[model samples]
Target: MIAIQDVKKLSSEEYLSQEKTNLIKHEYINGEVYEMPGASSAHVTIAGNMFFLLKSHLKGSNCRVYNADMKVRIDRLNVFYYPDVIVTCSEEDKGLNYYKKYPQIIIEVLSDSTESFDRGDKFADYRKIESLREYVLISQSKKRVDSFTKQDNNLWILESFSEEENLVIKSVNFNCAVSSLYEDLD
Candidate 1:
């Protein structure tokens, strides 16, 4: 596994200030900071496709889709990370300027470097968000998605879609063919 750059320890406030001034992106967990890596071409393409599809479906509605530039505050874990795509329908979250707390859906497009972290520790932190209903992970190596949806008893059910299957996002009543997510590639 490749090492993700680990900067010096910083407070949550300190990290935010650094992020505001610095051009690069970083994720803060506890007091440690990890610089976010650049996305692979495949990663970027998939994320772009999903964002456009989500934005179009949600137009004129309260739901809004955001790119990775938006930071999400995981208060329970004292972490701040940028997801590939985030959809928030909460009025309170919309009122905020810097970060969102109540995102209904968070999508992360996986690359070789970040897939394990995105699927493991990062997911654990995301699950702590009370307002989060779905977490979706899209694979850059293949046409696949693994979605976790929170159930009534707090258990998250995993649904995997691959090949030509349709990916369904029940939170927003949205579904799209998996092939659409990988429109252009080498």
Candidate 2:
């Protein structure tokens, strides 16, 4: 994500208003908006696969799976991020038209450009959402996934999965082969 230089910071309302009509997507953080770059084919495929699998699994349940277009709002941090995939079962979130405040699971397809941010500051911000149970990072370059599950004490535990393992998302009670996420990419 790159900040639009020389542009003054915007209020949350102002950012949302512009985001709706803007052709490109921007992630809002601490009153500043950063331009989100286009995803690679692999990134798109992995996110699509995860969304499809989760959506299918949660069809009859109250949970809803959203792709990258949906935004997850961290009100406490005054930030909004477009996660690669999000699973929300909160009734309150269902009524909101623009963003979800209570996502149980958040998935981000990692790229060289955004990996560090996703792993560091972004993860820290996401952890502030009380309803978030798991934060997942999937590598588009390899069949690997890293999951950070929030413990009862509010601590996060990391579990890494390789190509041979099934990536288990306990928060959503869903699991899938790691290879399934990288369906059609070189």
Candidate 3:
């Protein structure tokens, strides 16, 4: 669980500048900051598996896969998050900054400590991004993936897939076996 501190808040710009030099990872929301905890072995493994799978699938395509080290900027909410895996096909996102303002797909590996926040507040914040078409949640304890895709009218539709099924990402025109997504994670 992340430790909630009661410190004097700073402007978003100040928080962003200070975050660059800070030793620990801090998620910025509005003017407040919250320290992020390190992922468990299972969490890391799941994230790594997804990263590898997505990277291989996206090779030679305009989309790029990034791990948790990259920060995503939610302009509408004025916040930044380090998603477990992010796929961005936006040409404008290829700039020099370590932050990404637009992402077509965002994946979050669920953990016991952060699952609630990831599903509730973090997911809520991520939905504010206009460029986000899909949000994926991978369970660390099971072979399941939950995807929320945006419809034409901006409504999000939820789809769940298990190891017995295939997962399709229509936004990126990609489909893969669900087993492949959970490979070597046991």
Candidate 4:
């Protein structure tokens, strides 16, 4: 999806109102809104698998897992994103029903069109969230997972997982097999 940077900048109120009435979802960053594209089957399956694994692992815990429909707000960066998978254990986030401001983990399933955005600008924006401990990227075409864990306010360390290995997610306290994420896909 193309970022509508040419369009007039919208205020948070205007974007929120328009987003509620519009059928297509849009992400807001620094006053610009970008219309989001629909996810492919592989993207959906991988995201679903991660959500299931995280949810199952966090059962009886205070953490809650949300799918792509839920919005995440990076207050410091003034950005909003519909991450493929969002896990928040913060009690501050639980009080809100519409959008979460304190997400512990955010996962994005990469596609050909969005891989760069997810890895570059989007990751930069997500890093502004103080509660974000881990940001994960999953490849749709390969059994690979990349995780960036925050070492400090300004330091983030990258860790990668290959096909045969399981991604040990410390933020959410779980391990998910990379192969299981692409089970039905070639």
Candidate 5:
């Protein structure tokens, strides 16, 4: 999704309030709000597939899986973004209904318009979250998944999986075939 920035600067409170009432979603970056465009059919399908796998795997566990609509809050950076999928196990995150502050896993399905930002700036922003254990980027146009797993040393390691491989998200103790994420998207 391409972010169309709004010229008028708004506080966090104002952005949160306006966001709830707005029909479409908008991301908050610092003090500026940017409108998020809609996703394509394949993007939506892949996200749904991922959400289904995660939700079913994490059922009855402490972690809660959210798809597309839940916003991730980066308080220190003053940024809020809606990831394609997110998982949070923190009890503190239960207090908020609209957003999550301590997500263990964040997944973004790449598009031509947002691929660079998702891989660069957005990934940089998400790395600031101490609670984030894994950041995943999935390709809608291809059957590939790249996982950036946080190491014990506070460094990150990249692991890529193709269609035949099993994608493991150690943070959530979940694994699935990479092809499953692209199911029915022909």
Candidate 6:
């Protein structure tokens, strides 16, 4: 099990600069840090597939898609997370070194090693961002997609899609046949 520590005292700059190199990725929350494990082949495939589809669809538009290395900041919570895939339509986020805010769309390709946290505390932390419109969790082992969209009253609604049907992401005004998201994964 990963040990949890209190991190309410560290500055964002201090946290970013303190770590020079590491074998694994680490997520910084408040002042605490947790090591992230390497993803499996299936997980990578899903993420890559989503990136390709999103990238093509968002072309010539203000929105852009970023891969795993991009860091998204939740300033209100003083946290930084490396989302598997992030889509941003805000002009301020276009050339920023670090996203000092939440993304319009955040997607995590679920894997055995990180499914629980990805759906639990991580989602909780992400909700704190006011700019975030949708949170998506894509199953790496099965053809499933879970989407959480923020409602008019700032509440979130959960929507799930399987292989049998199509899914639409109202947040980004994007839609695709479900098969496109799970292609080449067998």
- Among the numbered candidates, top lDDT falls to 5
- Model 1 RMSD in Å is 1.9
Give a tens-digit lDDT track for model 5, residues 1-186: 434555667888888999999999999998878888689999999999999999999999999999989999999999999999999999999999999999999999999989999999999999999999999999977789999999989899999999999999997789999999998886
lDDT of 2 by residue, 1-186 (tens): 657734688889998999999999999987888899989888898899999999998999999999999999988989999999999999999899888999999999999999999999999999999999999999987789999999999999999999999999997789899988888777
On the 0 to 100 scale, the lDDT of residue 52 in model 4 is: 90
Tens-digit lDDT string for candidate 3 (1-186): 332445677677887888899888888887778888888877888789888888988999999999998999987887888899999999999983778998999999998888899889888899889999999998887889999999989899999999999888888887878777767665
- Could you tell me every candidate's TM-score relative to the true structure? 0.94, 0.97, 0.93, 0.93, 0.96, 0.89
Error of 5 at 177 (Å): 0.4
lDDT of 4 by residue, 15-102 (tens): 7878888899999887989999989988999999989989899999999999999999877777888999999999998888778999
Q: Report backbone clashes per prediction.
A: 0, 0, 0, 0, 0, 1
What is the lDDT of every predicted structure here? 0.90, 0.92, 0.86, 0.89, 0.93, 0.83
TM-score of 2: 0.97
In model 4, the number of clashes is 0
What lDDT tens digits, residue by residue, belong to model 6 across residues 64-92?
Answer: 89998777888878888889999988888
Clashes of 5: 0
Clashing pairs in model 5?
Answer: none
Q: Which window of ten consecutive residues has the lowest lDDT sum in model 4?
A: 1-10
Question: Where does model 4 exceed 4 Å of error?
Answer: 1-7
| Better candidate by TM-score, 1 or 6 | 1
| Model 3 spans > 4 angstroms off | 1-5
Choose 4 or 5, whichever is better by TM-score.
Answer: 5
TM-score of model 3 vs. true structure: 0.93
Candidate 6's TM-score: 0.89
